[model samples]
Target: MDVDNGMLLCPTHDALFDKGFISFNDDGSIYISNKIDKREYELLNINKDIKLNFKREQLPYIKWHRENEVQ
Candidate 1:
């Protein structure tokens, strides 16, 4: 479904991003869905310091994912 609006993410992050369980900012700071529990996030063992590299063009795609698919 991603076509031109895609990036190469690690499997965990990729799935999470596609499902809208996670997202990235223009600054590439990662954010988890508020629906996710703290314990669950801790158990996932995602890197607390990880950041994605996003370009301006990707904003619309990411926004569409967040607005339409995100829980």
Candidate 2:
């Protein structure tokens, strides 16, 4: 993970983003549950409202469908 930019880089799968923080679910699925600071939230809101693709560069983690892997 790139600590400076808060970009998470999973080696087992592809999933990256500039989130304030993150947590994993029981099913091994990653969910964005970051609580942004007031100032940060404002900026994020602006980006979201403008439909900016922040996660565009990140590949989604699609491991559930793999028959050998079970979370």
Best by lDDT: 1
- For every model shown, the clashing-pair count is 0, 0
Residue range with the least summed lDDT across 10 consecutive positions in model 1:
41-50
Please give the distance, in angstroms, between residue 45's alpha carbon in candidate 2 and its true position after superposition.
15
Error of 2 at 4 (Å): 24
**After superposition on all CA atoms, how large is the RMSD of candidate 1?**
2.4
List runs of model 1 lying over 4 Å from the truth.
1-4
lDDT of 2 by residue, 1-71 (tens): 63222233443223213232333333434443334354664443323222212332232322222222222
- Write down the TM-score of every candidate: 0.73, 0.21
Top TM-score prediction, candidate number: 1
lDDT of each candidate versus the true structure: 0.76, 0.32
RMSD of each: 2.4, 11.2
lDDT, candidate 1, 1-71, per-residue tens = 75659888878778887788887666777777887787787666666567877878888887777778776
Lowest summed-lDDT stretch of 10 residues in model 2? 62-71
